[model samples]
Target: MVVTRFAPSPNGSLHLGHAFSAIAAHDIAQERGGRFLLRIEDIDGERSMPEKAAEFRKDLAWLGLEWEEVPAQSTRLANYEEAAQYLLHEGLLYPCTCTRKDIAARNPRMGPEGAVYPGTCKGQSLDPDKPAALRLDVDRAMAGLGELSWEDEVGGTQIADPRPFGDVVLVRKDAPASYHLAATLDDAADGVTLVTRGEDLFSSTHVHRVLQELLGLPVPTWHHHPILLDEEDEKLAKRRCSPSLADRRAAGEDGRALARQLRMGEFPAGITQSNA
Candidate 1:
């Protein structure tokens, strides 16, 4: 059976973009008689709000989307640690002590996630007691995997190349697991057969695919649907203060009607759609 998931971080209220993504995953599963799952990505330490997770559930329920709940990342620290240990044992990971300032000073080229890590600590020998983040040796990993690829429901087969992101962090000093590490593990653990989210995360799939290969996790197909955009053609993001779904609900908007409009490619005023 196909299983899809809508994993959201509870750092803020759910916005239209989030609602659209959830509805997309839910509808896909319902159409196929498959299972749709929900996961709370509250692994950002104090920045993650448990209360917001409750609000996220309320927003999804209000939108008429149903999903089976899964264990949040905060509850799966051991799983992430175990995976990290396995990679460390295999020499596919190294301790990185580079701070954000350290990376910026290197004049590194830009990548999907801000400035690409310059591999400053790639081959450095470090103290075990020093505070550091664990980074995946993407070069060595891809060398071992020997040309990997994944299928996308819309884009079809995509050759995986994670080198552009540099040696991505698997575990950080402040957090138990990075999104790349936790999301990949959680998807496999939940028996997800299809991963669906916005197209902006399309590049992230490369990093996730490499993690899946290194961790010996099950591979699932992906469907990166179009993202909802604002009047300025910017992707609707919580950080930008986009109008939230909770706000719409509070105004007595019809949740089911809004969902139907989204399904028909109709969006509210000032909100547009973009696949780029």
Candidate 2:
């Protein structure tokens, strides 16, 4: 069965971009008679608002979408810790004590996400007691695993290359797992067969494919659909203070009508979708 998921972080209100993504996943599963799952990514303890998750449920229900709920990331800490331990035991993970400021000062070349970390603590004998983030040794991880690839519904077969990410973090000093590790494990755990998300995350799939292989997790097809953009061509984001679904609902707008219009490529004024 084509099990699809729309995993959203419960840090803020659901915006139109989030609505579009959820609708995409929901419709895909519905069309295939497959299961649709919802996973709340509320691992950021400091920023995560429990009430936002409830609002997300209300938002999805308002949009006429249904999904089976899965355990949130916060509730899956042990799973992430176990995987991180496995990688650490296999010598695939190394502890780094470098702060973001320390990394940025090095003037490192940028990658898909941001400034790639320079190997400052790769071989250093850092104090184990010091708080440190765990980074995956991507070079060593891919040493023998040659010519890896994964399929995408939109882009077809894509060659997996995670070297550019430069020792991506698997565990953070403040959190049990990084998004790369947690999301990969959660997807496998939840039996997600089709990972539907925005196209901006397309490059991150390269790193995710590597994690799935290294951790011996089930590989799933991905469909990175076009993201909804604002009039300025910027992706709608909570950080950007984008208009949220709750706001629309409070204004007496019909969510089903909005969803139907979204399906037909009709967006509100100042909203448009990126090229698929």
Candidate 3:
């Protein structure tokens, strides 16, 4: 059966963009008579508000979307550690002690995500006691895996090239695992066959494909749908303080009606669709 998931971080409230993504995933599964799963990405340490996860459930329920709740990221730390150990054993990962400021000081070339790491500590053996993040050796990981590609629902087949991201971090210094590591593992563990999310994360699939190949995990087809944008043409984001679904719910708005409107491409006054 086709399985899709709407994984949301519990760091903030779900906004229109998030609701749209969730409804898209839920509809995909429902239309196919498949399973729609909800996975709470609550691994942001203290920044993760556990209460927000309950609110997410309420919002989804309010939208008349049903989903099977899966093990959250917090409960899957051991799986992340195991995968990290496997990669470390394969010599595909390295410990880096470089800070954001240190990388910015070097004026590193920007990549899809941001300023790519310039391999400052590539071969250096820094103090082991110092806290460090585990970075994937992109070059080493993609050595034999030539011409990797993944299927996208809208964009068709995509060539996977993670070199531009440099050595991406798998395990952060503060967090147990990065989104790349955890999300890939979580999808595989939950038996998800169709990964759905906004188009902004399209580039992330490159890095995720590499991780799947290295970890010998099953590759799922992806659907990077258009994301909602505000009046300024910026994507609706929590950091931008976009209006949240909870606020609308508290106003006694009809969530199902709103979902239907969103499905029909009927956005609110100031919201518009932006292509990826």
* TM-score of every candidate: 0.97, 0.98, 0.98
Better of 1 and 3 by lDDT: 3
Residue-level lDDT for 92 in candidate 1: 89
Q: What tens digits encode model 1's per-residue C-alpha lDDT throughout 53-125?
A: 8888888888888899999988999999999999988898999998999999999999999899988898765
For model 1, give the 10-residue run with minimal summed lDDT: 119-128
TM-score of 1: 0.97
TM-score of 2: 0.98
lDDT for every model?
A: 0.91, 0.92, 0.94
Off by over 4 Å in 3: 125-128
Quality of model 2 by C-alpha lDDT:
0.92
For model 1, the stretches where C-alpha displacement exceeds 4 angstroms are none
Which candidate should be chosen as best, given lDDT against the real structure?
3
Per-residue lDDT of candidate 3, residues 188-235 (tens digit): 999999999999999999999989998899999999999999999999
**Candidate 3 minimal-lDDT segment of 10 residues:** 120-129
